[model samples]
Target chain A: MSCWDTIADYGLRSLGIGERLLPRDNFTLCQQVTLIGSGMIWNVYFGTLAMVSGFFLATAVALGKAAQSPLLRKPSEWFIFVFRGSPLFIQFFFAYFLFLSLKQTHPIFEPFTAAWLGALIVLFLNTAAYSGEIFYGALQSIPKGDLEAADAYGFTGWNKFRRITWPTMLRLAWPAYTNEAIFLFHATALVFFSGFPAWQQRGDALYYASYFADKTFNPFIPYPILAGYFILLTLTVTGLFGLVNRRLNRHLPQQSRSKLRLRPNLLR
Target chain B: MLCYLTTGKHMAIYVSVLVVLVLLAITAVTALIFGFGGAMAARSRFLPLSWFGKGYIAIVRGVPDIAFFLFFVLALDIGFEMLRHGIKCPDWTAPIWQGNDFVVCPEAKLPLGNAPQWVHETYAFFLAVLTFSIVFGAFAANVLYGAMRAVPRAQLETAEAYGMTHRQTFWRVLVPQMWVYALPGLSNLWMVLIKATPLLFLLGIEDIVYWARELGGSKTPRFTDYPHGDWRMWYFLALLVFYLAFTRVSEIALDRIMRRLTHGQATLAGEAQRKAAT
Candidate 1:
């Protein structure tokens, strides 16, 4: 097939579009690049949805964790610990099974079995736990002077939190939050490899890369293409987060503000 | 069968846990060695060495580790076979990469083609360890670099004033103090390493996830012995519990160690300790 013909047939293969069958023999460089690049749509989908939803949930979780009462604090603490402690791969497996069992008993929940719900649920909880820890640390580290200033100005409870505590916590946590965001994006690649089967053979980038590797018995070409896509994704995420970090730290004097540092130590 | 759970699958699960522990230990040591070398190179007067170390850290950090895992496994496998081919069969002249097949002379296989199954398993396990080390080594290098920088400047100056050699001062003052600074980042990295153990399944090692799927899939009487509905979910739930407990225990232990490391240090934790004592 010509390069244009190959593109037309396989460009949307990952979405169960034009191509009925993947290239079997004579896998060309264009085929590998286009197919893997097409598969990247799933990666971006999982990462973006998970990060966006996980952000709000994580904020709530962090607030719960910082609560004064045991009723609120205890549950949040346990939630954070359970999700943070377990591997995301295992979480995917466990969640898949749980969803499967639930569907068996109640068919109405069958929608949860697909990646849209199953993988998203796991990624959501996992990122929340990780970001919760970061936010919790930031909450604790908020300057006593800031709280005192709020109190002196008669900023009470909800108002105090809204006007003072929340902004400060976000500012303090922003750098670490950026690290958590990048890792969450990377962790999304594990979704297909875990319990959630790639429905209709429509898999993610790594999945397609593995498919090509298995067929051609050559890992040299396909895997690097996948890696290149991910590196680009990682750079884009870093750039976007840097912009947010800049906005968060805008009020501070340049010398007093902290720069966002990429730390790869954050994991599921 | 219940008997398989008690004997076969049970043993496999436990063995997989040991596999994870072994991988953890090997990766930690290997990465530390790599990190130390990288750190020294980064601080070297030679610009090329410093650039190489910095570039290594940056490249690994930018890419997802799963990508590296996939790439290295194949690269290393090919590289190994080619080395063996060069040594064991110098006269042989068949192309190793013919279209799709990577056919080396039968004599050139690392775990010889005729070797027992366990040899093949061990080879896969070794590859998994190497992948983990290479990826985690970069993170370790970053942490160690920061820790090395964090060591107080005055101590090094005093050693220089006392006419101590650079190596002597580095060993006596810098190395000792660097640990206190390095401990926090290392502890965080340790947690990450623990969580990453599940990737072993992807590497084709029969870790817990493998057994979970194998033993949990629906079984019919014709398959072997026990027949049951799909119970893979329950098996995975058990795996989750196992990991959660493992990580919780590690967290508690690490917090205690951090406390010990921070005692009498100038950090905020030390101030808190002093206040509590008073």
Candidate 2:
């Protein structure tokens, strides 16, 4: 087959759409690139969905964590700690099993046993915990003067939070949150690797990359393609977050506006 | 094997925990070594060395580290076998890359085909440690590099004015002081390292995650006693509790160590310590 036919055959293979069986022998560079690129669709889907949903959940969690009442604060603290303390790999295994067991009891959880929903839920919770911690840290570190100023303006309760607290917390947390988003994108790679079965051979980027590697007995090519896709994904995430960060800090003077840096050490 | 330990098995569970702790300790020490080397190289006056160091540190920035773990284990294993095949089986003419199979000579096989089972397990574990060290080392290098820079230039200048050589200044003045700055990052890295230990399962090592899945899976009547139907949630919950307790203890221990490390240092932590002491 020509490279175009090869692409047509395997391009959407990761979505379990175009191809049934993977290339067995004579695995071409084109096939590797095309299939791995197709696998990136899953990565994008998982990352985008988990991140978008996790964003709102994270804000609520951060607020809960920052709340004064123990009723609210304790559960929030425990949720963040439990998720953040454990490995994402372990969390995937645990969640996958939990969903499987739940499915045995109730048919409603049957969908949750699949990688798409099961792994997404795990990724969502994981990111929420990490981002919630980041947001909480930012919330705590928001200047006392900022709150005092809001109080002076007679902004109280939810109004005080919605107007004054939330924006400043986001502005302060933007850099760290950007790092968390990138990490979450990277973490979507782990779902397929974990216990969540890639039903119908529908796996993420790492899955296809590993498939090519296994078939070709060469790790050099496919893995780099996976890394390349991730690099682009990371860059895109950073750019998007940076745009939001700029808007968050747009009111502040240029010197005071914090630049969103991609910190390498923020991996977990 | 202890009878009272548990009805199913306790030794494997305990051994898994030991493996995790060992991996953590070894990875931490070795990664610090790699990080220190990378940091010093990055800070070197030589351009090439600095670029290599910077490149090493920049690697983890864009890529997910799980990719590194997956890629490097296979790559490193092949690399070791290839080197051995070239040296030990020099007379052999068959290509190592024979179509799809990596046909290294039997003698060149890692742990050798005839080696004991423990040797194979040990070799795999060793590769995991090396991979973890290499990956985490990059993060540590970034932290250490920043810490090195954060050590005030004035301190180095003062050491120079004291007639200390460059090596003396670096070893005596810079290294000692940079720890205060590096402590926070290093502590964070330590937590990340603890969490990352479970990835060892992906490297094909039988870690706690592996055991949890294996022991928790449904067992048939043909299988011996303790037959259960998908007890994975419980096993994983146990694993979760194990990790949570481990991290909690680590947090306390690390906080205490930080207090010790910052007792008389010249940073905000130290200043606070001094104030509290008085």
Candidate 3:
């Protein structure tokens, strides 16, 4: 079949549209590309949703970690440690199995077994822990002068945090936070490979790429195409984060401001 | 039943941890070698070699490591088979990549095609190690390069004034001093390497993740004498605890080592140590 025909049939295959069965024989480049591209929609969906939601949760976690009371600080510390210390792959497996066991015990929890909820829960907690650590470090590193200035102006408690502490914490954490965001996006690839089953053979880009590789016994094509798509995806993530970083630092003098540098050292 | 947990399949789970450790050791050595070479190349006067080393670090940075992990395993397998086909069966006429089949003469097959099951497992483990080394090496190279630069120029100049050659200074002064700066980054990388061990399952190595799924999944009487419902959650929870404990221990050990290394040095950590002691 021609490339156009392949696209027409498999364009939305990942969503359970247009095709019932994947092309088992005569796997064309177009079919591989189209299906893998279709699969990318899932990756972007998981990454974007998890990163966005995780951002707010992580701020709360960081604040909790920075709290004066040991009651708040201790739990937040352990939460961050548990998630940060373990593998994301294991987290997925554990979450899936936990969800499965929960489903068995309570049929009402069945929805939690599916990838939509299962993977999201894992990614959300994972990102929150990582970003929480970054934000916690930033909170500790916030200039003491800023807090003193707020206190002198009679700002205290919520007002002090809102006007001075929170903004500065975010600003200080922005660069490292950007790195955490990109890693979270890349990590979404692992969701499918983990214990969570991709319903209806619907999976992310790596899944479809592996499928094509298995079918064609050719890795040279499909894997590279998937990598290409991921490269573009990473570029887009970097661009979006860079824009936010710029806005966060907009008030700072150019010489004093830090740029969103792509330091790969933040992996994991 | 719990009886199955004491059987050979359970043994597989324990053995998988060994596989992970073995991969860790192999990847560490190979990545260090790769990192050393890349670090040296980046410092080279030659523009092309420096650019190539720099590019290797840059490209792997943004892309998801899982992408490279998947890509390299298959690509390396194909490349190896093609090499074996060229050498082992010179008289064979069949094309290597025909339609969807990568058929080589039976003699050209990796692990010799008819080798024992253990040999095939060993081969897969070897490939996983190589892939990990290549990916992590770039990160290591980046850290090493920065550490090398961070070593004060005055020390190097003093070495030069003493009539030591650049190579001698690099080995005796620069390399020794660079570790203090590199320790934090390298320690973080070690944690990443530990977390990455689970990806071995994707490469077909029967690591902890694989066995957890296998042993945890629902078992029927047909499959085994002790049938049980899915217990993967518990197994993975056990794995989670193992990792957390391991990382915590590593963190403590690394902190101690860093403290020792920074003792009597000019860095902030050293100053803190001095104040605490007094």
Q: Please tell me which predicted candidate would have the highest TM-score against the true structure.
A: 2
* Residue lDDT tens for model 2, B33-69: 9999999999999999999999999987788888899
DockQ of each: 0.65, 0.74, 0.72
Cα-lDDT of candidate 2: 0.89
Expressed as tens digits, the lDDT of each residue in A103-175 for candidate 2 is 8879899899898888999999989999999999999999999999999999999999899999999999999
In candidate 1, what are the lDDT values of residues B1-278, reduced to their tens digit? 55757755568878887888888889999988888888878877799999998987877765567777777888888889999999999998878888878889999987898999999999999998888888888888888988999988998999999999999998898888788889888888888888888888888899878988887888898965667889998888888898888888888999998888888887788899989999
TM-score of each: 0.93, 0.96, 0.95
Model 1 Cα lDDT, one tens digit per residue, A17-71 = 9888888887899999999988888888988988888888888888899989999
Please provide, for model 3 over A131-228, each residue's C-alpha lDDT reduced to its tens digit, 9 standing for 90 to 100: 99999999999999989989999999998988789889989998888778788878988889997898999998988988988888777888788878
Models ranked on TM-score: 2, 3, 1
Pairs with steric clashes in candidate 2: none
Model 1 residue A40 distance off true place after TM-score fit, in angstroms: 1.1
- Which 10-residue window of candidate 1 chain B scores lowest in summed lDDT? B1-10
